[model samples]
Target: MVGAEESGRLVTVGRRFEVVRNRPLLTLAVGHMTVDMYAGLLPMMYPLLAGKFALDLKTVGMVALAYGAGSSLSQPLFGWLADRHGTRYIGLALSWTAITFALLGFVPNFAVLVALAALSGIGSGAYHPMGALNASAVISEARRNSAMSIYTTGGTLGIATGPLIGVLTLGAFGLHGTIFMLIPGLLIAVVLLFEMRAIALRPRRTGGSPRLVPPPVPIGPISVVVGVMMLRAWSVFGLQAFIPIWYASMGYEPSFYGLLATTLVLANVIGAIGAGHLADRFGRRILIVGSTILSVPALLLFAQFPGSIAFVTAAAIGLLAASTTPLLLVTAQQLMVGRAGMASGLVLGLGFVMGAIGVPILGAVGDAHGIQNAMRLLALIAAASASVAAFLPSEELVRQFANRNSNALPAASLPTASS
Candidate 1:
């Protein structure tokens, strides 16, 4: 019943809001890339450190454990802090991360090395929740998936490229060569500081004080989303833990492992960007369900086949499996509308913890029952996750969140993208 002129005006307004809201997110994505690059450093350096310290498997694992404890376990706490306080210090946190991880090559003893890794982990943990919150806040509800996907892709790209960087740096200058890597982190941190300051200059509505009270909303849908994420993580980490070992057992060179990993990860980056763009038009739930359903078969194909076919299936699995993550994050933020920091922390941070836990469990199963059987189990988990995706919140609930009271809300109270 609206007039044609009024409709055109409304359309123009929508477009303008979309452009303004999404402009800040690209800067945040770069910061995400810089922070995640540090995560890849540990994996690349592990071999050198193990050889240098004469570390047994147990000792090596302990070093990983130290990093994991700080990075994985503390994310939720940081998320709460960001939501309750403010994300103004995210740039500073990145600088902290740069300093800690860059000092890796200078540690004098194994204990010192472990301590530094833990400190670096803490810095990494502090960066994600705030970064995610800022990304969500700066974008409109409809564009959330696309924006987040772009952000996620940056991290994936950084992680994929990090091994190459590490190899070149260490090969040229030995262990102490890590000092050079600090420059990028510091540079990125400075950029983020300026970007965040510019964002602050814009006028914005303020949010409520942080409280201990639980969010007053239906918990069922959020729980289902979290469960789906955890299941996905289990499969992902299982593959990450064993893929290189599987290739080695087949007599492939170590560099082949890196090649395969880079291919899968790059494929993931592509999928994330593509899926995000598609989800904005096609709807998030369908994209998530369809991708997850397809990934089970892709994973099975990868495990059952070998050689080039295996690489193809691995790419497919990575594409489908990895793309759903940003979608899941957007969904969680939608469900807990005002708690973007907490939602981001829960989905991204907790998912990492779950993946870390899954590695050893999957490793044990592989040892006991054979890696093939273990891969079969991962396919089953993927299938289960796909099944669970069917029960997300109804369309009506999603619509209410998106359309009702949209403009009157504070930035944090705005409904998230993805139903």
Candidate 2:
């Protein structure tokens, strides 16, 4: 028979063990979903915004630029802060995003709308690295790829659902419907805060001090990964930003185009989850290369077709193109051992910035040429990304390189033989 003290200890141990379980992952996944839903809403709302403001495609693209610049450019700083300190403010960041994004509909002018979008993006920027860091930390190494896929799926699913929500709300109430977007974000923020506090209260098993400065990352391999990510982002963002306008010009209604956009993003969810498991089994580089290569043809088909056939091609584009996201993320993290946050920031931030920049360029192309021609350009970009992905180091090489760098000290920090 156990004494009262023993029973209490058992309960504490059980609670501590629970912190490393699926609950925290679920909480973070939900938070990711809530944050990324806003990203999805922007593209869906572009038609409405343009109609109201009498804006051209280029002007509408500026909204994406502002939001993307804020979110993508600020990631490294937030990541550095998370690495140095703990991610204590993650929930606060979510709350801030929810409030700012909710105000988007209430803005008096286009400039004000752009500004609010940027502000909301800043909050999203803060949440990403923090959420990613925790997502990786809560799971074991062997399961990281799968775990990241699940986490990323949450965001992808949110993006998928966002268009539907936008069509429903904006269709009925117009701009004022954006106010309802705040509800899920706020609720998820509370859940994340509680989960974070619980995890913090759990006892630490290791007393070792964390390294203040991480080892140098492999520049050659990381650069290749980033290049691939950038080109892919260029294509994906172009599609997301332009698909609605492209279809609208072809005389399709909001309901039809919106569902098409949602279908495209939904395929990303399926691809991400499947790719994660496949990467764990086959290899990351192969998956990256094959997916990007296949995406070239899929993108071409998407541009060549419209209407019912376009949906099938869109799903193909989503699966073959956006599926590499989690794999690239995991590859970046593996290239830098102790600097997961920084690695995540660099990969996600740079990729997103490229996407942001591409939106305006694609819009310009759509203006000068045509939207279909601009989409064909995306196919060319995907081919380039496939070529870049071919140069990425294998999993075995990456592990060896990361381990070596992590264990070695800088020349200045190394101990003298005489000592």
Candidate 3:
């Protein structure tokens, strides 16, 4: 949609930039709300399902693991597809996600449930690339940090809301019925795919000859940034998985723990936006280093106590932890140049998969030692990620990306044809 209009002497780019930037935000909000709606209540589901199936904690955790596994596996493929085929491929993926996740609700058998969970994860795998690519399209080189922050916040909001929706739906419709909540949200995301399809590929139409084939993946500072992100994901996931249990063990009531989870997410939302703005104005390294340093004290303090102070500390932890995700995402996007889809997958997929692995490992340590003892490593890892981030060649990386690709705004950064 980023058409340039020619006067007798001057050429003006149309509002395509705004449309590209804003549309994805709208779509991502819908996508994440549905995903968050599911996430918010995911914890509450395990015990109920375990009872219905007569399963143990280990087995139930596997179900969650399988979901993560599904999400992790398809990332490389979807990322590849998204890059080669452009954002249009997300249409197939969105519809597939809605249908699979909705149908997953109908399966009662344990084995079937496992399979469905994997399928749902696959669907989720599709959503991330499109959202990341869309955000990348709208963000100018200068404002990518800000754009990613806003885009990633939608996800935080979704994650924040999911458990609440599950809990509320639990009382209203029971565990089986909560799937109804997710169905509409998935459908909405599927519908939004049409809008994206209607918007032609921006890179192709920017008065430059379109390269149908994406170039080989760049390997340098981009690789370094992604590795650091993967390491940090381990700690983030470990904390997200076990914090509530730790809080409950410390004598916090279930309802309060629930509220605390939501608070952490809410704080994360604030952190994401703030970090993005900060990254835009200051620079990525400063945001990453500052956020990580703040998180260490917050996580340690929360682990140290129980009650309002602990919850407050946990909220601070979330603020620091969640804020880093968007910064990481945008940085990866900037580094990868033409591989926006692949870059998103590498950052999010690998980081999250590492997080999935971290949960059980942390659980094992908590089982043999203690939860608090195990979490010290999490603090250390966060420190490392931040330290590693400070050294990443961000300015040089952006320059490298610009050296490789067309010097025009991507579809994510442009307005629609109608505009």
Candidate 4:
């Protein structure tokens, strides 16, 4: 009887231990979701913004460009700061984004809306690297790919929900519905601040005295990865920016188009999580190359077919195109060894900036030619991304290189990828 009681207590203790261990990752993941939810809102709101402001496609694309530039351009700087000082301001960053984004609906003029979007983007920029760094720091080495997928999926899921929320709020309450969005971000921000404090006090997984300077980055491989990522982002972001407008032009109602956008993003979430596990077991390069190649056909199909058939193609595009995100993130972190934060920022920021820049270019094409042609161009971009992805090193090579660099660096100069 006593033995049975002891066993029960042990099981309970083990369960408690597991939950405590996972708490930080969960908190950061939720934070990622909340921050990205704001990003998702923009595309859904674009059609409304256009109608309200009497803007053309190119001008509407500028709104995305403004947000993307602010978010993407500032990431590396914020990442560098996070590495030096530690991620102390993550909650504050989330709160800032929440406040700025909530005000987006209330803006009286196009200029004010654009300016506020950029301001909101800065807050997202601040949160990303800090959140990503902490997410990486919390997990075990063997589980990095899977763990990152979970983290990335949080953001993806938030993005998936964004269109739904936008359709509901904007449909029912007009623009003022944005005010309600502030609640979740603020609540999550508070939770992160409390949870992360405990994590901050814990001993770091990386041993040895901290180094003041990080080692040199592998520019060649990183450049290749960035190139592929940029092309992929261009396709993904371009599709996201234009999907609603295209559907609207076809006479689809806001609810139908919004649901389609949600389906696409939700498919991305599924693909990201599944690909992460696959990459962990199989290899990153194969999945990256394969997915990019497959996305070309998916994009072409979506562009060629409209109506009911479009949903199927959009899901395929989402599944194939965005699936590589977590894989690329893990690969970049593995390559950079000690400078995970900086590498993450560089990869994510540059890719996003390219996507941002591509939106306006694609919009110009749409203005001059047609939106369908612009989408076909995304297929070409995906083909280009596949070509670049072919050049990426295998996961085994990246691991060996990361290991070699870690051996050369002074202890704790940067967190080792393996650590």
Candidate 5:
């Protein structure tokens, strides 16, 4: 039988664990779904909006960049908010942000539309870190990677499905006709936001407890992980930006492109789960580096062959490229100890910015040079970023930190080493 003192310690630790993540994982999952669904609406609107404004490729790229900017720029503020008030407020804010974007589709002017697009992006910025915080609160060290992989796949699916939505809406509504379609998504968001209220009044358990979490992992290793994500994002965003054009030019029907995209997204769903499990058994750093290295060849090969082979290669590239996402994030979180929000934001905010910037750069390149050149450059990013992942230390930094902390190691001695 356990002694009282040991039992008390267990209770304290259990309670702290409870408070950190007493909320349902489903809640976090639903939150991810709601926020990401906003991205699904973008591609559907892009063609219609471009025709309406008589915009060129560059202008349209700028419009896409505007949304990315909102998603990027708002990270620090949301990260800080998550750090302070907990993620519920951030989640609530993001939900409303989605609602605004839904309505923003109704506005007419191009400039106003851009502004609303940015605002909508800002709202979306909250979903990731906020959802991550909630997930981390509940996820123990063992299952975090898998849970995150599952959650992130939602975003990939939304992005993949967006073009279909846009096409269908165009067929039905004729450009602006789909503006009203956003209302239902907005209403869904409002309903989900209500769940936050219960999560808030639940109770706090982390206060005044003996520190049981491990030592902080090194920022350098985490930075390396973030760098890998930047490259992955670049490749994903670049292809996503131009693939529809490429497919059309290849003499494929829109339906064929749609089917190809759906296959790629499905590959992502499988890749994320498989990668998470791989990260668990082998190591995060190894999986990240390996995925990166393999993806480069896959992407380059795909670029060289732009028809059926490219479709097959794109799925292979996507699987390897996206597999690293959760591992990178999990590495960052371990590095930060209790600070899931900031660690997550650092990668996501920075990577998304890099990816967003890549859109305009590649757009201009596609205009000036050609789409092939744009794709080639993105493949380079995949290679370079993956090479960097080799340097990140993986071996359960959380355990490393917690082990060191238990020993009451000197502050100067505990330098957040990941190995």
Candidate 6:
């Protein structure tokens, strides 16, 4: 009876460890989705809010800027902190995100609204690097790309759902309905706290936590990768900025605009999920460059054509152009293995900041020439980004170098004669 009981105990123990290993990514992914839903909430509600406050377009843009600055600009600091310490506050960050967004409905004026938006942004920013770092840590390098893709898909889907959720809830209950948003955030926070504890307590295979020590990656190659990401961000932000306005100007209904937005984001989600698998199977570089190159023609189709063909081309652009994001993220992480948190932040945070900056600039260009011309410029920028992507070393080369360094570690750590 004692032996049988011991065997059963062992089986239970094994199952628990398995759950500990795998469940955090799933939890963080859900957390990511829940928090990012708020990111889209403000934009969706902007029309209603503008009417309520009698604000102009420029004033509305300020609210977005406030949110963008808080959420994006502060990512590097949060990421660095996550790397230096750990993801202890990830749950707190997400919970705060919920609180802030829920309060957005109650703000008395534009200033308070901007402040809450910033707080919401900060909350959103705090989770990303920490969640991404934790996700990478939870999986082996071989499966990292696929795992990250799965993780990212959750957030992308969340953002896509945000607009629909906003329209339904706000339309029904007005601004005060945001109070209902608290439920999901609170639920996810509890899940994250419990799961993160379990993962933390799970025994490390190496018998110790791996301390953050800088890895050696060439500055030139990584710089090129960062540049490519920034350029891609510009195009992404530009499309997102102009698509609705362009459609409205052409006399399309709100429903049509929503469809376009949905198609683009859903296509992006599909691309993000699929591209990761392709990156793992084929080389990362090929998928990155090929996708970017293909997206240009889709943009051209979008520009040159009209009607249903434009919608099809928009989906194509989304599928091909935006699909490479996960691949870029994985590449950055690989290049800086020890600093995965920082890499994630740089790719996500910094890239988005550049995109935000491009919005006004693109608007200016649109004013001077035309919105269509501005979009053409975006296509050109994407092509230029692809050209930059060509500079990245082959995947095999990076992997071989990493393997060589790993193999030499034992020798390097061996005790000297004096010791």
Best by TM-score: 4
lDDT of 4 by residue, 1-419 (tens): 99999999998676434423676777888999999998888887888788899999999999999999989998999877777667855899999999999999899999999899899989888888878787777777766776778788889888888888889888888888899889999999998887766654122335454545556888889899889888999998998889889999889998888888888898988888788777767888998999998988899999999788888998998888656777888888878876777878888889999999999999999999999999999999999999999999877789887898778765545542222
Q: Candidate 6: which pairs clash?
A: none
Query: Total clashing residue pairs per candidate?
Result: 0, 0, 18, 1, 9, 0
RMSD of 3: 6.1
- lDDT computed for candidate 1: 0.73
Decide which is better by TM-score, 2 or 5.
2
Estimate the lDDT of model 3: 0.66
Q: What lDDT tens digits, residue by residue, belong to model 6 across residues 24-133? A: 66787788889878875666666667777985544655666677678778888887777666676588888999998999999999889988888888888888888877
lDDT accuracy of residue 172 in candidate 3? 66
Candidate 3 local Cα displacement, residue 347, angstroms = 1.0
lDDT of 5 by residue, 165-243 (tens): 6566656767555465455456655655566654431223455755344355466766777787777777777777666
- Candidates' lDDT values, in order? 0.73, 0.82, 0.66, 0.84, 0.67, 0.73
Q: lDDT tens digits, residues 204-255, model 3?
A: 4445555444445557766767777777778766766665566656775556
Which residues of candidate 6, in runs, are more than 4 Å off?
1-22, 49-59, 200-213, 303-307, 366-373, 404-419
lDDT of 2 at 138: 75
Deviation from native of the Cα of residue 400 in model 1, angstroms: 3.4
- The model with the greatest lDDT is 4
Better of 3 and 4 by lDDT: 4
Candidate 3 segments whose C-alpha is farther than 4 A from its true place: 1-21, 53-58, 89-95, 98-109, 200-216, 247-253, 404-419
